[model samples]
Target chain A: AQSVTQPDIHITVSEGASLELRCNYSYGATPYLFWYVQSPGQGLQLLLKYFSGDTLVQGIKGFEAEFKRSQSSFNLRKPSVHWSDAAEYFCAVRFSGTYKYIFGTGTRLKVLA
Target chain B: SQTIHQWPATLVQPVGSPLSLECTVEGTSNPNLYWYRQAAGRGLQLLFYSVGIGQISSEVPQNLSASRPQDRQFILSSKKLLLSDSGFYLCAWSPTSGHQETQYFGPGTRLLVL
Candidate 1:
């Protein structure tokens, strides 16, 4: 069956360190990919998304994701982590234009000053 | 520009009590609405979605029920609340037209069942 996986359940890093969150999907065809961030006691905000062209996609708050078809991965990256960036990140995928979205188990990022 | 609204930002109910949560979307039309539950330290679990008024599709079999009385209004209810029903409830809306599959989420409603 098709699914989305986030191997890391929790990650901690020092401030100003680089960050990478992995997202892998199992699907026959190309799917729509998205990354979202949620702060404590709040709703989720869209970080980035990938549709068709351009493997590298940039998003708000200095975040980017690269979509690799061969590897079936869309990993999020940040050059320098901030203390305020400590939050939970989620990866979601949709096979087609359908309304249903499959979300991965989320990864919680903790930043240390 | 579209916006979503969820009422009763926080709710506390006892077990066996009834549940009612309202969600409304403005600045758009013919949107695909969805309901999701997010437990503590977990990702989102899709509960229900609606394409049009009075048309609902349940994703999981649970004690929860959803209804779409108006085009932009979606409500989630339960006849009797369960201990497992305590979580953060979110309402979302996506456009039906265009290939824009992005979903806009509303401020979640936190439910605590005692």
Candidate 2:
């Protein structure tokens, strides 16, 4: 069985500060990893995804995630977060040869002034 | 360009009532469709998925059922709604060919069961 774990339930960061959301997954083979963001009362938007390539993958809205196979982690990061960046983040994993995505519990981001 | 649409942005239903939610995709053909539910403060739970019309696969066994009448239309239904069914339902589509697996999501429908 494949599963994703987001360690942080909630994270508060000041405007213009850097942000990092932790995510770990358990899978038997190389996994397809994705990061998605959801605003209040809105559907999720795909931020970035990693199929197979460079470890670091850039995504929309200046977001990026690095896939670390040895550690089974794919953490999302942003150099600077704006107030508008506040939202819920989720990490999802799909093992090769599978179409189903296993998602993490998600981390709520709160940007402060 | 491809887009996904889900109807009834918000819905309120009583327990034991029948439920129906519609999802449709545009600008794509032979795409894989999926139905997911997100409970309050929880991650997405995939309810069902379809590769083609009349080909539906359920990931979870619950009060809901799914149907695909057309290539782009998917429906979720329930004979009797339950309180646990109250959640945000999302419709997503992914290209089955080209080896692409990224699922694009719809605006979603929020359901409240009383």
Candidate 3:
């Protein structure tokens, strides 16, 4: 079964500092990875996705993720953290040409001023 | 540009009461629709998904059911609500024929079952 895992349950960072959230998935031949962000009491918004080609993918709101095939990891990163960026982040994985997507429990990010 | 809508934004129901949550998609047709529930402090649990009208797929054996009556309308229902059903319900839609793209999400409807 294909599954995703977010190792860090909670991460705290100072504003204007670089941030990275780790994600790993069970080994699969063709894994389509995605990152989503959810504000408190709001639905998740897609951050970025990786289907094929480049290992690094850029997304909305100045977020980016690098899909490493060898490690089965898709880690989300930002050059600078903002107070508004404090939210829950989820990593989802889906096989090619499939409807099912397995999501991680999520990592809660806290940005300190 | 496509959009998904879920309502009534928030609902409060008593245990054993009936439930009917509606989801619809616009600016697109024949898109795949999905129903997911996010329990408090937990990851999202996919309840159901539909590829076409009247073709619903249940992911887990649960107390809820879903239906896709029209091309763009999907509904989640339960005959008698349970306290476990209290959570945030989210509706999402993806392309029926694509590269397994990202699913677009609605604002979500918070359901509180007392």
Per-prediction fnat:
0.67, 0.70, 0.67
Which residue pairs come into collision in candidate 3? none
Clashes of each: 0, 0, 0
The candidates' DockQ values read 0.81, 0.79, 0.77
TM-score of chain B taken alone, every candidate: 0.98, 0.98, 0.97
Model 1: per-residue Cα lDDT over B1-114, one tens digit each: 789999899999999999999999999998999999999988899999999999999999999999999999999999999999999999999888888678878999999999
- Candidate 2 per-residue lDDT, tens place, A1-113, comes to 67889999999999999999999998567698999999999999999999987999999999999999989999999999999999999999878777787889999999999
| Total clashing pairs in model 3 | 0
Q: Candidate 3, which segments miss by more than 4 Å at Cα? A: none
lDDT tens digits by residue: candidate 3, B1-114: 888999999999999999999999999989889999999989999999999999999999989999999999999999999999999999999887667577888999999999
Question: Could you tell me the lDDT of residue A76 within candidate 1?
Answer: 98
Off by over 4 Å in 1: none
Of 1 and 2, the candidate ranking higher by TM-score: 1
Local distance difference test, candidate 1: 0.94
lDDT score of residue A108 within candidate 2: 99
Docking class of 3: medium
Worst 10 residues of 1 chain A by lDDT: A94-103
lDDT of each: 0.94, 0.93, 0.93
Two-chain DockQ for model 3: 0.77
